[model samples]
Target: MSRKNRHEEHEEHADESWLLPYSDLMTLLLALFIVLYAASSVNISKLEELSKAFDNAFSSGISILDKSALIEAEDEQNKSQKQRHEEIGIRTQQEKLMAQEQEDLEKLKKELDQYIDKNGLVTQLETQLNQSQLMITIRDNALFASGSADVKPTAQKLAVAIGLMLQKYPDYEVLVSGHTDDHPISTSEFANNWELSSQRALNFMEVLLQNQAFDPKKFSFIGYGEYRPVDTNDTEAGRAKNRRVEVSILRKYTDSSATNTVLSAISDEANSAPSTTTSN
Candidate 1:
């Protein structure tokens, strides 16, 4: 009875021991397959999740595949953070430049206002400073006689003073715009108001350009004729107000058109320069 019992117990235990080694082999294969799959995908989140599952099921720490994925993920995160910070820095710098430009224009406006006040020319001149530009408006009577585009001798001093002040801001672009009353004109010297207005703007700009302190490339002129009127032409006072010239120092941020104008001016100058032949 004892021999039969011992033999049966030994057989049962031998089959059970074989199953333990076979189970260990299957577990090792499964771990190898999981690591290979993780290597192929290379996702940090998925790798961590799978590692946590393996840790719960086994006595091991994180796998090599999971660690590699984690390293890659950290690298990508650092790159993304760096790029975002760079973009923010660039945006902040742009905002700072725009604010500085506004401050400079405001300072110029104050100086012009002080000069106009000291000269007692408030009736004939006015200054306005905004985000887009700093403008000085001069009444027609101060610069020219009736039906004439010629700048008065006294007005030349005013233009010189303005041109000198403009030298302080060498980076800015200046625009001299001429406006006229709604009344039409046709004369031997001028064909129409357009011709008169254009001549007036050109002549005034020529006077300002005489000061070598200012860059010729920075100045441009336009004659609006009677189209861009700020006041009604129905009254004498309003008509007088409309007949004026504006000297504008344009701000760069809100003035894309001004940049195009400046670029166009540069192109024109480049094209107008006389070509010379070079001998080889």
Candidate 2:
């Protein structure tokens, strides 16, 4: 009877094998939840520490979480480096383009100066290269008679020459502006200096457009009359200087700080230079 009672007691004890598997499943679930929380937090250092802890606890060499985090960090670093390289490349290209443009403008200015010197037109024509534009200034007497809007027949060759030089740079914008002395005019052809200046600028621009290479859309004409004079209108010589035409090739790319510096230098030079009185 005692042996039978002991056997019954052993049978009454619950099966403990299932408890081991259940506890293992609970542990696995907890690990999964921890992994999810770490990944959502985006704290790489904390994630690496957790991976190391999990690796040591499981006795595994390296955890999948660690490998995945390392790969993600490497990818982010590569993307950042690529973006920086692209930005540098773009800036380099822009600098190259700006340098080339400067060279072309300088060359053109040199050619124009040569032409002026060769033709003995230094007294009638002058060229100035500034940060904003390349300006070609011509005395009114070179292109027209006194108070006349018509371009002289002989001066048409000069216009043709300038147009030929400009053909090398088709992309630049050109402005033809006319200025006049303060003397009033009431001729049958022109009511005032404004009308005469406008007609003169239009006629000069028309001659320039005769070249087939020139795009008329890129050219503009304006007349300042006596409003925007380079010299005084009080004296005959100064008035002669004021009565002029200007052809300006506008710059496509300009640095504002550099332009200000150049302008200041030019003003200082003009103030120091000797003033020579020349008549038209």
Candidate 3:
């Protein structure tokens, strides 16, 4: 009975150690929840206090959470706006350039048409304004004598007048191409019409280059003798139409660097040797 009573007394006196830490933990958690609730209520004074406390505890200079991210976002927005403005400016300039080019092309076409109409040279010359270029066509008989590479004196005057007109617009490239009928020739001067046609084109180009306003470097000539004829050789009229000289004027705004490279290459090839005709 005595041992039983002592055991009961010892059990009664045992410390409640678990309750103390658990109560402390509960109080801390309650305080944390109450602080969080106060912060969520948008109390400006409490938020500032919390921020100051954290800054002091962490030894931080700035209080904002994502300063770098906000700055980067603003910078990207500014950059995008600047790019959009630049794109709009470029589009406006391009539109103005296109309009000016169209006006220039129309003026050139009208001048050629008037000249042809006044001189009664409709059968000899014609002009075209297509998407890529402006073309002026001159019949072979009008520019050259039969079986000859030499340009006639009257043809020289016509070419000079055309050159004068071209002088007004010096930015365009001049391409003088020669075409011939299907009749084969084996003369001492020319082995075939290809040689003759090439020479004639060169001769025309030389006359055009004589003008002080025209740039000799931009002039090029090619011969397509009997190969790229406009009409068949079966009929006289068709043959007449087939034998001709053509001058194509390229626009100024069409990839200036790339066009100049191609023109340079063509000039080198034409200077090296006469090109052969391939059937179209």
- Per TM-score, the best of the predicted structures is 3
TM-score of 1: 0.66
What would you estimate as the lDDT of candidate 1?
0.81
Candidate 2 lDDT over 132-168, as tens digits, reads 7889999999999997889998789999999999999
Over the stretch 8-118, how does candidate 3's per-residue lDDT look in tens digits?
999999998999999999999999999999877887898899998988756755435557778888999999999999999998998788678778888999999999999
Error of 3 at 263 (Å): 5.2
Candidate 1: lDDT of 263? 44
Residue 65, model 2, lDDT: 85
The lDDT leader among the candidates is 2
Backbone clashes under 3 angstroms, per model? 0, 0, 0
Clashing pairs in 3: none
Q: Please, what's the RMSD in Å of model 2?
A: 15.1
**Rank by TM-score (best first):** 3, 1, 2
TM-score per candidate: 0.66, 0.64, 0.68
Q: Give the alpha-carbon lDDT of every model.
A: 0.81, 0.83, 0.82
lDDT score for residue 224 of model 1: 65
Lowest-lDDT window of 10 residues in candidate 2? 271-280
| lDDT preference between candidates 1 and 2, better one | 2
**Model 2 accuracy (lDDT, Cα):** 0.83
